[model samples]
Target: MTSAPLEPFAVTIDFATGALVPDPDVLDRRLADLDGYFVADIDDPGVGAYTVHEVRVPPTGNNLLSSTTVLAPGKVGDEYFFTKGHFHAIRDRAEIYLTLSGEGLLVMALEDGRTVTKEMRPGIANYVPGHWAHRSVNTGTTPLVFYAVYIGDAGYDYATIAERGFPVIVVEGEEGPEVRPNPRYVAS
Candidate 1:
């Protein structure tokens, strides 16, 4: 009896041709940067309200390619605030949030400047559509923890985020107050 010849199962897409391929080693190394608990100061404007550590993922020497590990608004203690904004670049893929632990509030800003807020607890799955602007804040008494899983590169230029200025934030306060992006929070 004769056996049939083996066929190629490999397939490729033009869009993914020049994209930066994220490797496991690079991802693990980059993610290692954020290895501790972070705190945000609510009353101080000079100091950044959010604490962020980055996982550095170098580009694969490809054009139209970029990737990085960002630990933003992950764990919150008692109180926290996230400024409202949106990404100008329309992401072709959807973004997901994996709740590791804790609880917080999710805020979405509309094009017309209108904002919507939701109460979020642990085990809650959050999905943000491409190009959708959103933010999260911790309102619970305990620290809120979660993982942000962003898939598909959307240029990595968060255009929707405020460059510099006081952003809109809704919280349980005596008077409605505006919140600004923490100075320490750096996006790479």
Candidate 2:
């Protein structure tokens, strides 16, 4: 027996609100959810950090997966709010992020401890190559919104990132957001 074919559908992105019309399930991350991901402890861990809405799809074949991440602007000890970075479980699966509103940075790191950062702003699309662990940091005073697309089977390997940490971090500086080496990084 064979399964039915997947149907194509359309979804609208409300750029101003950073919402997906028709409403996809949202994953909310509070500071509490990011325990060791930051450099300092927050007085209120229950404070909202970021939210993610992903269009669910089968994790197979060439089907593309799409998601929207809206990172709230704030910080803990000068370190900006950020997503918990991850490498694709498949290792060779690449992804692209298109900034819709606000400003931020796309920080990517290689296993060799090398790192690079891409400025994220409206109209800019950053390509994250395979094997790079990537994270997004909200550097502006408003929510940083972006849409990401990647292969369906490009499962996330957050454990490696949680265990080893990224080589660099984004922090608020007198000149604005700055990228600095993470003293706690453990090369994998």
Candidate 3:
């Protein structure tokens, strides 16, 4: 027997507050949760870091999944607060991030050592192509919020990134946010 077709539906999202009307499954990443992901150790482990609230559909075919990431503004040492970056498990899946509020940097890097950084602000949509591991960095004094859409089946490969760090890092500089080499990076 075959299963019934899924019905279409709409979910309301408040751009200003980054809230979904029906509520969403939330994954809160606290300072303690990101053990080795940062350059320095936090004095307190319970500090609020970032949150990802998403509405997920079935992980089949071309169905799309959407989520909002709110990264709290702070730092460990001089490095800014950032999401735990990941590449799609499928390796060829792409994603897009539309900045809703605050300021941030979309930092992406390839396995071959190529890296790119894009400024994210309200009204800007950054397209992340396939095979690049992408991380979001909040460079402002307020929360950095962005809406992201990706294929449902584009599973995340966070382990690879945890094992091999990104080639570049973002840090506070006298001029502004500066991009520098990640000395801890190991080749895959």
Please report, as a residue range, the 10-residue window in candidate 2 with the lowest summed lDDT: 16-25
Q: Which 10 residues in a row give candidate 1 its minimum summed lDDT? A: 11-20
Ranking by lDDT: 2, 3, 1
Error of 1 at 188 (Å): 27
- Give the Å shift of residue 45 in candidate 2: 0.7
lDDT of 2: 0.90
What would the per-residue lDDT of candidate 2 be over residues 118-179, giving only the tens digit for each residue?
99999999999998989999999999999999999999999988998899988888998889
The per-prediction CA RMSD against the true structure, in angstroms, equals 11.7, 1.3, 1.4
The local lDDT score (0 to 100) that residue 188 gets in candidate 2 is 66
Every model's TM-score = 0.48, 0.96, 0.96
Off by over 4 Å in 1: 1-48, 53-80, 83-88, 156-159, 163-168, 173-188
User: Across residues 1-188, which tens digit of lDDT does each residue of candidate 1 receive?
Assistant: 24453343322211211112332222221112222212333332333333322223322222123222222332223224442334525444445554444556666544444445566565677776665556666555444444454543443434435442113443445452224333433333
Which portions of model 3 miss their true places by more than 4 Å? none
- lDDT agreement of model 3 with the native: 0.89
Q: Count the backbone clashes (under 3 Å) in each candidate.
A: 5, 0, 0
